[model samples]
Target: MEKNAAELLKKYLSGQCTPEEKAMVEDWYLQLPFQKKAPAAEQIEASHDEVLDRLKQRPKTRGIGYLKHIAVAASILLCVGLGFVLFNRKIEPMAGLAKKKLEDVLPGGNKATLTLADGSVVDLDKALNGEITKQNGIVIRKTENGQLEYIIQDDPDAVSGTNTIATPRGGQYQVSLPDGTKVWLNAASSLTYSYPFAKNERAVALQGEAYFEVAKDKQRPFKVRANQQIVEVLGTHFNVNAYSDEPMQKTTLLEGAVKVVAGGNEVRLKPDEQAKFNAASTELVVDKNIDPDQYIAWKNEVFAFNNEDLKSVMRQISRWYDIDVAYKGKITTEKYFGEIPRSANLAEVFKILELNHVHVQVSGKTMTITGN
Candidate 1:
């Protein structure tokens, strides 16, 4: 037990630690009970003399077990200070929150709309899990797993036509292109591609965010155009986030290679690299040693935030939960780092935020951040 560690724990208990310090203290404290080697009493005495003296006054029968009980009590106090109540070994809303009975919004799921070449719209959510439509020799079907797939049949008379698949707010969808490329569209995103890819190129226009597993075709390169930026690759696994509301467009490579071009500026990316394109400055910058999982976590049914700002986190929440967000007064500048399951209901997600001292008021489809 170092002096610094004791000080950090004290700050965390009193809710006076910084965001980074809070995260560190919580992580360490949660694992303290299960640590293989507990610190010696002498170490505690050296760091926190008052705590050791208080422990010594207790009965000998309550030795290490008494310390464990103290740890549990401290944890409970920490939880309460952070607006959480421990119930049956689970974290739940405080009594005040429970009494409010806030309206719970369900999480997003497989939902999208498919626009045919003829401008006909098909709601994928209501469409049957079978042949959705047949255009020329291309057979579009909705799989049982809620994936929209295209099967190309050999037809000499087949002609290429443009088709678009879009996911509305609180929705997401997966699609397999005519060229066998797999795409996972995030909430409020769209992907437009040719029914039968042109002979010399396979191109798609993307809006919002999508993760792509491009099919290999040496003769025809795969290109994704998003927010005035283009990502070109023969075959690669990558993710692109080009939401209009976001400050910058991001392209992260997971495998193979990709060349991101924007405003006549270009940068080639290797695996584990991310290219950030700023539309305002028309500058394309590459970040090395990036973690691709964080960018693609949404596709895997999780919301991963790595030192993200509160506004950015709320934007993702608004899109996925189909809600509008507004802020009042000054908000905390603390950066958040964690993951929340996409399956969690709105109330559950807000509870997590409350644990971080973010106060939110939910009214129908809108959420207002009152304070922190």
Candidate 2:
């Protein structure tokens, strides 16, 4: 039997519904098949419109990449308004979106996930930093040094070794391979490497943010599998961020030659070159004049913004900190130019904004801004 929406909403409002009841309401509202162009929707949509404006003004967008990316968007959107409500006008009710925030992270941060070869999954968000999980001949441990590492399975055929490491939104980790190939996994990112990566060929799978300084292997060629693309190189330094939300899977070459292949399309890049991949359209583009710091700053414990918009900026913040963003009024489409050190206090981030004439406010963990 189908439950009435009004009844379910009232039950939720009164806190008289079970967990199941609340979920049913959320599913019904958010998953509605028909997109009704309601008149009231427009009248009250300013709040959300303001959010969209703020998002557009900042710089770029993850572009409905998936649910994981959208989770923190609302938090960053509504961050400024959160300190105090907009004057007088009825705030547009993002019922469906609001409910999602409750079901996910409220604001300030997100969680991560770990998958084993055996198909077991660990939610890294709730778990502590050290000694997370182990399985499938893989010893998953957080070293006393406070980084996530995988001990490759020992096998008779294993002349060399490899393993995979991945991180999800509201999550980040670092790893040091036996051969001293250091990797830093960013929010909503993943990587896979072989044990004693073979002499002839070295390969790994990656999505999202990672900084790699490949060990010099004369005999073996290192490769990274991301989305449908593969990046091949022998010895070099580089960063890859291929979040599904963004339009492209970017491979930024720091100091070596790398061949990026998308589908049958292939392109080679030299130092200071970046390969961009579009997952939806499956287009490959070779871009010159790249910014290496802005691409790989996360590895250095910093979030660098270079002429980026609110939507795009919020996307990064949403993933690392796992929050929701909303807004009221006109969402200005503008670009922000700044380099925020990851270790910088929240006040520092706002201070930079204030200096730029970008109005910003912080309430607790949520950070918001008003565009000019």
Candidate 3:
């Protein structure tokens, strides 16, 4: 590859490239010669050495695996890289993250508490798979696959009741709204909606993070109230991150269209676009260049961080692991670029951090971080 192309890839990895530049670099990456079949063990080592040697020719950076070009290339080469490693070595790609038996923290699953308008709470995790309850002529059932779904009866006399489903730390859940919209909540998140959606509009209150695959209803626009922003869409797939600890609330659209309103401003977002709302200002900035997969990866049971900072990564870890994080030194400024399965234990997560010069010490459920 030409030096210019490498430089462009570096920019793309760091999330500094424009939409046009990102597309160009992605095209160039696809054109690279990748192995079609799994190579022998000897060929595996040779390819690894070749990749390492090429990486060594690049400028060194502060953090390990934090090399700008290398990390960028690694993400693009993930399919080819992991396929080779798995087919040849028959080992986990991230062999470094050994299971931490002593302090193993499993990933979050379909766990949440559903609160009815009458103030009755149902533990979705323990509740048997079937009709859990009935409110306002809406039948709430726990599906065999561990999903909470609502079936609205055709009774015109059906009442409307607001219900809330909350996922605790180290827990997550999925629910189908009465309007047939599917929502997947992440750990430490909640979604509140009326059992029978209003005839005029469909609205839901949200906290933390959630992914939505809204059912098409052009007559009544679907609106989500998350933090200080409101996302309105007719029918679309989107992900919203409104965690209180996060610096900014992000609304990323994956399909169709949506209008995000924050403060006194409103911006329309297209597919693959994201709207960021800062707490300090009312200005809603719409970023045309974005990767929706990184935002919704949590719903898919993976932790995907693209040019994410150490503190940001830890926030997700702390919530998912249900652990506390304390900083021993000024290391939150470090940036990481990679993906890891959320199923990994706490110790395994720490191992990945260590590779990036982040030293983590876990005691019980508390984790302390220090600079390397």
Candidate 4:
């Protein structure tokens, strides 16, 4: 079977293969069988090194004709080599792959709580669209898209009231503050602000993650307080990640400029810059010329990972799925590179992770990371 498959693949690579023969080779590759037992780490590492050395020895060519051969070889080698890498990492073949469907957990959606100044809490998820309540002569309505919007009324005596919106784990929400500033609160986040804005400044306190589009009001500076850090802006776009569990708080600027104050330090950020604040340190580290889109990708319902480690990736999964994560032993430091749609179920996500040699067991709302 190996000899026949190799012959077919070789013919296909030569560009002289028939359509039926090409299809046969593709089918064989796609159905490559998984080994019942995993290979040792050293053996897998040797295979990986061997593949790299062989590829590096191949003669370089600028001719387009050589491109197809290189592509074919690279594709086939990656599949076979990656399989070995995964097997070695796990130290055991995947189990319950076919039985992971006992129950699948769905992703988060727009759900939050709206706390009025009177200390009344309304569940936005259960509230009907339009006219949830009225306070300080301002009308609060739940939009058709599950967003919370404010409508200011004409009342000279009306005093601006404070309100808070909070999203629990497995939830998200968007809101248009009384000053027209737009905010998207990520899962396990909250935003608190005074409605109708005060005369001097507009401020909001945030916990967890949020993307903000500050309504340009040069007269009133927009300030967001996330823990001990404060980001002051004058009509700009930015994202703030202040999850309590995270090691550092990050404020990324997408447009305009902002002054970040944290840990007895301050920095003015330009466009496409990220300021990181560690509570233990008295300095703000700013990363310039970064892709701000990566910071705000969650607002678009995408889990974007760029060479992220397993623990960091799982942290996001835990919040989005509202599941507890436990490692059977020492956690893996393996890095992953890929993007997964936020709409995928927990089972679907685990299936992809399994390809990377990550073994997991899901029971109720708990996920045990058994290996790799």
C-alpha local distance difference test of each model: 0.76, 0.58, 0.73, 0.73
Error of 4 at 311 (Å): 0.8
After superposing candidate 2 on the true structure, give the runs of residues whose Cα lies further than 4 Å from its correct spot: 1-114, 120-141, 149-164, 194-200, 327-329, 345-351, 354-372
Ten consecutive residues with minimal summed lDDT in candidate 2? 81-90
Total backbone collisions for each predicted model: 0, 41, 0, 0
Quote each prediction's TM-score.
0.76, 0.59, 0.76, 0.77
Candidate 1 lDDT tens digits, 1-372: 223554555676678987766755544344232344434434433544444455446332222223334433232222221211222222323346532533457889999999999999999999999999999899999999999999989999998799999999999999999889999999999999997888899999999999999999999999999979999999999999999999989999999999999978999999988999888888889988456788898998888765566899899999999999999877866554456788978766665555434566666677778664
Clash count (model 3, backbone only)? 0
What is the alpha-carbon lDDT of model 2 when measured against the actual structure?
A: 0.58
Q: Write the per-residue lDDT of candidate 2 for residues 166-276, one digit (tens) a residue.
A: 665666777766455778788878777665556578778887778888878877788888778888887889888878788668999989788889967999998878888
* Ten residues in sequence with the least summed lDDT for candidate 3: 83-92
In model 3, residue pairs whose N, Cα or C atoms come closer than 3 Å (at least 3 residues apart or on different chains), thus clashing, are none
Cα error, candidate 4, residue 365 (Å): 0.9
Candidate 4 lDDT score at position 89:
23
Q: Candidate 4: give the clashing pairs.
A: none
Give the clashing pairs for model 1: none
Across residues 43-123, which tens digit of lDDT does each residue of candidate 3 receive?
333445455565446332222223223433333332222111111111112232223431467666778999999999999
Best by lDDT: 1
